[model samples]
Target chain A: MTETTIAAPERSRRANLLRTQEGVLFVVLVAIIIGLSLLSDRFLTVNNLLNQTRLFTETALLALPMTLIIISGGIDLSVGSMLAWSAVMLGFSWQLVGLPLPLAVLICLLTGLLGGVINGLLIAYVRVPPLIATLATLAIYRGFSFGISQARSARGFPEEFAFWGQGQVGPFPTQFVILVVLIVIAHLVLSRTGFGRWVYAIGNNEVAARYSGIPVERVKFTLYAASGLMAGLAAFIFTSRVTTTRADAATGLELDVIAAVVLGGTSIFGGSGSIIGTVLGLLIITLLRNGLLLTGVKGDATFMVIGLVLILAVLINNLVRRR
Target chain B: MATQAGRLTQAHRQRGLFAQQEAVIAAAILVMTFVVSLANPDFFSATNLLDIAVNTAYIAVAAAGMTMVIVSGNIDISVGSMLGVCATIAGELARNGTPIPIAFLAAVAAGGLIGAINGALVAYARIPAIVVTLGMLSILRGGLILVTQGRWIESLPEEFFFSQRSTLGVPNPIWVMIAVTILVGLFMKYHRFGRAIYAVGGNAEAARLAGIDPRRVYMFVFVMNGLLVGLAAVLYASRFTAIQSNAGQGFELAVISGAVVGGVSILGGTGTVIGALLGSLLISLIGTASIFLKVSPFWLQAVQGGLILLTVLVDVVRRRRRA
Candidate 1:
């Protein structure tokens, strides 16, 4: 209930360092890295590590906003679908409809914005619950993705288009670099601004926050649109990397992003979580996946581990709180 | 005395609201029936009706359980994965020469076991139901693929396709859906445990103070959900000659949306199986209506999503008017 938890000052921050989820997860993440390094030589390599980061850049993009969304006591289950829809539209417009690639990308981002705004309008203005509103969009967008593309993938984009997806920026994947930059921005926005405080306030108690003169509807509306915009950018990165845009792109991705955020110790009920925690959570998941693949585990099998980790993370959080 | 009478009337009107939801859904079903019959005159043929019923059967059954979970103030995003797991179990067992009935029962039992895990975590570990189920969703989905390696079960005894046959001129699948809906619907209405679920969802602390064990209620709803999922799995799995490991992917969305569209509030505490079943029927009709109308089947998902949003919008508007 203290302001310190939301925007920790240096002194109080240090005091709660050991008790915070970020601290525990940092220790756990280090232990995992070391343990995986021991288990597989390939696991500790810079190439593999960056490769892992590159793999999740798109979803990590989503986790960034998801932290805010959950902290605001709302959820957007349509992000994966948003990614697919945007990706599909990006491809469809450019390849099928003969639009310029740059314009196509703009359309993609616009589609994402439009979808998010609709979700926000439904939830904030119409008072539809977040879960139900997003669920509807999840289907509608994915369907449009498939239908617009006529169920076929769009491929063979201009050569320059691949740079954002497959290009490297001094040993860092381009997408990861973009992700890191966004992470910092999201971090500042979430922890160091009145807007961020409003998100936490809304999460803790929407009615109370509203009575206290916060613009609850505007904040929620903006967050959802932000989510959609992020999903749109992710869609671009994902399609560029894979060099293909299919309706099924990023299928089940919402699960992975959610798993990472929740595993980072964000309360699903909202109001408490940090960008650092989400980043570490994302790192742990990506590392475990890469390590498992190195250790002869199939990529998909890591989903089982992630699922267990997601649950165990919350379990540990509950235990810590009780203590 | 005046306030007492007013309070009684208010309660009566509240009950009437739920009845209104059911009536609205039934009306939708009637309207859809007319549309289908008008568009495809042969749609009412016994054969065509049975085919449609078969499709609606599993969805309605699953949504009925989903209705219970939502009414109890929780959700199970793992429904699709659980259904996949259960169906795979049934298929794998039958392929291993197990009795058809035993395989079906084992699938159902496995569902209950998984549900119990979800319940236990949500109840005892103090994990949010969404997180617990999301974890289960990942675990089951990943584990199923890991175990099956995306293989399909092709060979099966004739008796394994129990749902494909007609009984007393009605396909067995219709019978299964109807029986499950009837039983679940009645239990939810008249049973003490059912009413307790409503109390717990409406307010857990109030229910606990009023002598209801909310934990037990949570467990019961989840477990019951699992059992219904089992039945749904067996029925769904029986329809295909080749049981793909990925069966039921994205199915939870359909089922949950069906329940919500049928009138179950995502925030919980109210909805009925009859409404849910009718909602499922309505969805099935829309899907078929597209094909019958010569619209691309791809538009079905968008229609479903749009319908959910439309229904929720109506619900929200009506509730606002009442307030």
Candidate 2:
């Protein structure tokens, strides 16, 4: 029975491709962009596009490692909290230790990686479930962020740091360019590297991957560490954009990143997904948010619309998959 | 025949032992309450006890529904958002001179509608429950913010407030909670529909083979959960006298924790209304004790995390022993 059940899907591989999520999501993205542009004059403006792209950069950065982690059959619910912790650490290191800007940034990223390593060790070795493990780390990291920052905002970073948040290059926002470069690198690694294949294989079946000689624990550990590093990088950009670091910064961004991944058609149960789809998902979310804002919908209302879109996207994804 | 009788008796004895385990936890809670009261004489006062009950009522009622949902192999992280949405809608209706009961019904039905959408996606469309619900959480939260424009609604009708006032010696919220508990408890034990829920959770393929439609069970549980969330919203609004856009933020965690602590497995398959009620009481006790003991509010999240870890760890150990 098991053989038959597994074999049935393999026999229809070509049909599965035609029914893949990316094609459907791409069509939806194009339709939404065109529709929103038709409805609002500002939707297609270059300035508005740049602003929208900038807004998505933080989540997009975090989503890269999140994509890999999810593909590797784990989750990091603490990334948003980790971002706050990293930002706080970066601020404290610069102000108290007088570390140079580059060193401070590296310290922040390393802090994130270490936090991720702790989570990975607990999950992969200690045998804690990913959800519970990350949930605990989420609280711990958030608490640590508050303790170190004394629940206060940290300011006075060097002026040059603001360039990452506000600077422009060739008619595009710097953040947008950064996100695009990161996306390209991430896409290549996932598509071109054996490490990427191993991630998918692990997600698909840990036992099978182990039997095939994949270093399951090491791959999982690295994916988690990578996720934390990306979150740290996101924190850097976010702090720069705001020109301040608060212990409470990015309080709920993990939800947004996860929403984008799921919106992009990544199976939450793991195994199959794509970077391109995630990029498109990010665009869709950003545009929807910007469009609602331009329509004079307040932030709260905009959140509701995003929630609706998320549900709608998943419903459509499921419908497609079933067919 | 003798061997068969011995095996049957052993199974009965094991079931009795499981029941005793639940009783032991309940006794521990009683003892802890007594100890806490002794330490803080104010904790034993009528007002403080009533306050604890009122606070636990909403979460307890919501957790009951959530327990059933989780036991049936699904989860609803959107309860918090649903509560916010329901409260906002109720607040709006009350302000518009709608009778209190009508507004309350509208609030609950609104939650039911959201749940139905979740049900359709998860059951009919075959999407994974976690992804669909997680997306719903964001969408609902966003919707609440959008509808309220990040503003608090403080103009609920007088009758709406009055309904939460004490009836005899018991607060109205407590009575409502008791009513809900009895109904859910009876349903879980006696109703064919209820038994089918357990069957589906215990083994979906087997349930399917037994001519049960697991999808229907999924849809029913989600809808029921939504209604309960709406009920919670009414209580929340009355108690606070103000409904913020972010009302019930992170509520899913509280509900999930309560359900799990009450012996509901995160993996799903088993739970009890009594267990969930006790779990809610335990959490409320901790929260109230923290305040009475003058523990820093900063430690609340950490303590909650610790309690959750402890509960799940014990549950795992117990299950292993049983196996």
Candidate 3:
């Protein structure tokens, strides 16, 4: 009771730390950075690094909540659609309703939260499976986006609004700054809050968590809402950067976000993950794309390289874990 | 004891009744087909029906394999991309004067190799099926692009086109579909290996205890899926007379949707070849109907999304009532 039990916990904790999938991901990230730097002089340049960081900001923002949701054992297949829908809402609020820029941003985020809440309620409370529920919402939200936007793009936003996407703080892009702040906030919420503990507990074992008096449903619901909120924020940055909003904006983006999260060592079955790993994962993805572009890879070939890297990363992670 | 026995018998009868309820979905599908035919006289034309069958054949074949894979508790979103890769290989071979049979074999083998990689990662490496396959999707697409240098290969030998051409008063693609359906149906119903798939899907832990290697079973399913997808790719390339990296873009959604509508559960462990075939037919008909009914082509994705949602809802309701 004195020595054996105390030593057991410490040993297991160390094992957990060493055995994490993120350990492999971190190694892969470092390896890729080194390899790419060697492969291309441009890859290590400060300008390219900044561009890579900016490129990843929107995707990283979306992946933060996605990490939480997946950790809770659910998926948000609708995030891509949610991004488009949120953007459309923001566009409408700005161009049609003539709302203030801040108010438009608020509405966009609110729309995303509402979408996430609906997904959460349906999956958590109504007992619908996550994939199906989110798949449905993906269509609904995308359809709504198209309906509202009439399959057209909304553009010509105020300069101040677009500044969020393009402006920089010191040497860092605004989007990059936004992503860093968001990641910090997310890291705090996930690591320090009771809600975070509940999420992990629920993902590990929902019945046991429920039996232990945790509000499993509420936590799950809030996680999904958080996912939506992040998606909304992503839309803001994506549209701002692109300087246009279309119904099909962010089409197929959910897969990329999910891929990054998974590559970052997040388990699809949920229960354990970290925002830091996701941040690294996003950086790895951005770097891969940028490096490929610098190397003159184009179109689908770039996707192929990224895909190979993802498979190799996960495979190595799995092999390491087994050993 | 007598009261308990009576209650048990009542419960058994209730279960039997519920099993019969699934047939209602089949009936609904039939009724819809009839109504659709009534709405458009052209729909009942033998030529149009044949067109539908021919169009459905490739997807149906792929969906058959996908159904088994999904029922065994995995997925292959890369089928679309795999198809693209396979088609490129076959087209490249055929263009170089390879015999049709050998080219077809080469394509299928290429797909199988890709699938084997997926199998290795998911089974031996213990990676999640979705992430592995999602990566495969991109990898295959990228490989295809690199191989063709983003150019469409439009020239193929005349024999390559014969697969889509009619023979014996039946479209060759439809004939291939039928042959595949019969063979797969027989295999699923009687083969020991096939039975293992159901056992694994039904309960992996129990199957493992019963001496089945769930990983091996999953490997077989993934490989078989890849082979079937290759076959589909052959048909696709033959029909279109062109192979490009983007040829199978969004094909995964169509095939998965077909499987879902055919009564395959996305969660896996339940589905049928016949159901998948029917689901393929339903989906094919929808696409055809959209064209015949002059609905905007833009709405195709939205409508398909709606149908997927409806199918999942039906599955959920059926499962709930059974419980």
Q: Using lDDT as the measure, which candidate wins?
A: 1
Q: Is candidate 1 or candidate 2 better by DockQ?
A: 1
Which residue ranges in model 3 land beyond 4 Å of their true spot?
A: A1-24, A92-104, A147-150, B1-22
- Full candidate order by lDDT, most accurate first: 1, 3, 2
| Chain A TM-score values, per prediction | 0.95, 0.92, 0.93
Q: TM-score (0 to 1) of chain B, per candidate?
A: 0.94, 0.93, 0.91
Question: Each candidate's DockQ score against the native complex?
Answer: 0.83, 0.44, 0.53
Candidate 2, A191-260: lDDT as tens digits: 6798988998999999999999999989888888888888788888888888888888888788889888
The alpha-carbon deviation from the true structure for residue B154 of candidate 2, after best TM-score superposition, in angstroms, is 2.6
> Lowest-lDDT window of 10 residues in candidate 1 chain B?
B1-10
State which candidate, 1 or 3, has the greater lDDT: 1
Ranking by DockQ: 1, 3, 2
Candidate 2 CAPRI level: acceptable
Instruction: After the best TM-score superposition of candidate 2, give how far the Cα of residue B62 lies from its true spot, in angstroms.
Output: 0.5
By DockQ, the best candidate is: 1
Cα deviation of A16, candidate 3, in Å: 5.0
The prediction achieving the highest TM-score against the true structure is: 1
Tens-digit per-residue lDDT, A250-302, candidate 3:
88888889988888877789887778778778878888888778778875588
In candidate 2 the C-alpha lDDT for residue B190 amounts to 77
